[model samples]
Target: MRPGIIDRYILRYFLGTYFLVLILILLIAIVFDISEKIEDFITRGATPREIIFDYYLNFIVYYGNMFTSMIVFISTIFFTSMLTNRTEIVAILTGGMSFRRLMVPYFIGTATIALLSMALAHYIIPISNVRRLHFENLYINQNTGERYSDIHRQIKPGHLIYLENYNPDRKSGYRFTYEVFDGQKLLSKLSSDFIRYDTLTGTWRLDNYTIRVIGTDGDKLVIGRQKDTLLEFKPDELSPSLYSVTMMNTPRLLEFIRAERIRGSEKVNMYLIELHQRTAWPFATVILVLIAVSISSQKRRGGMGFNIALGLALCVTYIFFQRVSVVFSTNGNLSPLAALWLPNLLFAIIGAFLYRIAPK
Candidate 1:
């Protein structure tokens, strides 16, 4: 079916205003960001190419996704309020246009933007963040120091793993400890403080080490440690950011959540929150659009000016809730999914109520 003339007009107006407002807000943000980073770039002797291409390009995208809902709400308010104030909306309704039909174009526009934002956030923006964050750390923070060694994090149930000193240049950690436990009782402890791998033997050489084994009957045995042994652990897994929560994608995030739960780790809340929040964020586009349309569509004495103020306040409230919910998630008091999406669920209900009272 062909779209009516009103559909085209509404689509053009909605999308045009959306992009226009997005650009205006992003440009202002970019200007401010550049102003702040300019001194750092100058002091670090960074090239203009590095400053613009390496940093600001990704910086803009990160901020754009972060502020997407605000842009949507503000743009919708500006466009819808303009139509109401100019009497165009009334003219269209009088000319046999139902508000429902008029909303089709706006919804289409928002759906497109929502999908785009989702793809950029999930797939594209993260890759950019890797580079942008690297640039900031390397240049801004002057993090040219040598990478730390002997880094180990607990990976199993009631087990402690340690690395003596890892050499990132060689992708290896020397002198490792892998301990296993049953409840509060230690079942076995493997201590190798001078462990080194022999490329020729494909085995680890542990110098002056002892393996202590505990019996279920409360007995202990000292298993003599050999100068050389073989284990299946790879040093690269212990590298910085390899297992970092931020570096993990959605699947890995789920895997971490599962494994951490089995291990009884308390630090998995942040990862769980990130996983649920990524999925929840896309739906917010629709929620905010509904709220913005309902809030701004009614004609008022002050028109767009007052509507814009209200929209800004509502946007801030929504964002504030989003951040606050993360605190609950991090503290593990609230379910991660609920913590991330509670604001959207509540606002969606409010949006529905407001839409019902919006002008027909």
Candidate 2:
């Protein structure tokens, strides 16, 4: 067979199997999701059109892109193992085709899927998630209220703000305190009995406020009534929803991260995790394909069934590793880049080793 024809043939088979596997898996997922949310749909009066268009359509895009890499790896293992079982790989190898050359078609197929996955992740999926999440909020989940007690945040470096009780509906808080610190020592402190956002002036209206400026020698205290001062936080920012960062697209997420850095938002790591994962996953999928080909391309007694089970196990392990690394980044000291990409880096080494040892 001509190399071009064989490459095209192999590439076609890879892509076809990928879509076939993707559809079956997505359908199973949708069935389970619908069963779980059926009661919510009925009680919340979710129309069929809304269900199909707003929720599941966007649902497929988000969830499909999320698992695209895993599916591609599975597809690679399935098809390559079938070729090995059928002895097509043996024929091709004996017919002057090198093992490395055999990888060309698989690499092309995987690169195609990787680029599509990357596009969906950074550009398309976030937009889809917005509508999907909105539909869920309206029809399934409705917990929109934010934090109401003991709100603490750093609006900037060395600047701390606190509120005992905050009301998002009213855009105000009670028992508000603002403090300025210099290294280990407190420079000044401001306390308020009641505070309300002044929409007209874009500042805070403080009631029964006290200002204490600490000097090296002594502390100066001033008590005032109805003080007006500009604070960095917006009204909505007081009770930021934890998962709100996932809704923004790449550009918006970057801008928000920049603003949050200036505001010293503590949840910046979570946002960074999402940001890094988007680019990281597509590249990781490429590594996964290399591993898949190395393991599945060899003929063995167990055949395709063995490859399939082994592929599933490896995919699960990789995903679990990814989730754990994300936890480390968000909850532990690991930086987002290191935590997210570390799995890929480790797996790449494994892939290289396997590819080097695979039968030629």
Candidate 3:
């Protein structure tokens, strides 16, 4: 349906204010980030152009999506409070437009933002994170060492690999073992003192290795000084940092989660939380818009300040609850779906309650 004049007016103001607020918040974040990292950039001899285009460009996208819900709430509160002050909302309501009907344009505006946010979270952000994270690791973290220890994984069905220590820089491992199993029965085992990945040959070179084959009759053992073998796993897959999940887009993330589960990784819960959060975080935009309109639509004695303060308070509470729930999911036995979504669900109910009693 073609939008009427009132709907168009409200949508135009809402979108204009939303983009303005988003830009302002991102600018403030970039300023603070530069302040904190200026010394590192200077010490690393990072040029201004590189800093602007390479670092802050990706930085803005990351934090912009990160804080979209807060921006939505603030924008909605600011614009709706202005409408209340000007008595535009009162005029519309007096003209037989119900408060529920007034929400149509707001919902449309928020849905647009929410869809954009979801797309960014699931696809664009992760691709940008590759460069952002690489830049930070080289210039900011500056800690280059072994990222994984005592690693174990099932690279494929019935094939297990273990490493006592892995050095990502050298692409080598010490005390490596590979095992093959058949329905809870050991088929064969390969142990090596040291294993180095031969990038030229795309294979693994095992030094001072021993292999044992198990059969119905007995175990057959073989020893060798050096050997080269093809393996299903790669060095990169074996040594991922805790934050590696953030670098994967949705499809890669799903594949990683499946592999991690097969490898019996305890950190799979964190990945699951991240997966659920991509969608859940964006959906909060709608909830926050409803809450903001409910709280800010009626002009009070304290005027816009009162409504803005209340909205900020609620936003803070929402963030606090979200963090607490994530901690529960990560540390406790809480389900990731429940932990990531509980805040949105609770606030949605609050929005409904406020909507019920909001001034028409």
Each model's lDDT: 0.75, 0.88, 0.91
lDDT of 1 by residue, 4-58 (tens): 7777887898889988887888899888977877888888888888888888888
Poorest lDDT segment (10 consecutive residues) of candidate 3 = 139-148
Best by lDDT: 3
Per-residue lDDT of model 2, residues 183-236, tens digit only: 879999999999999899999999999999999899999999998899877886
lDDT for position 39 in model 1: 89
**Full-model lDDT, candidate 1:** 0.75
**Total backbone clashes of candidate 2, pairs 3 or more residues apart or in separate chains:** 0
Which candidate has the top score in TM-score?
3
Question: Residue by residue across 81-172, what tens digits does model 3's lDDT show?
Answer: 99999999999998888888899999999999999999999999999888888888778886666456888888787999988988987899
Task: TM-score winner between 1 and 3, please give it.
Answer: 3
For model 1, give the 10-residue run with minimal summed lDDT. 234-243
Q: What TM-score, computed on C-alpha atoms, does each candidate reach?
A: 0.80, 0.87, 0.92
By descending TM-score, how would the candidates be arranged?
3, 2, 1
lDDT-based ranking: 3, 2, 1
Scored against the true structure, residue 206 in model 2 reaches a CA lDDT of: 97
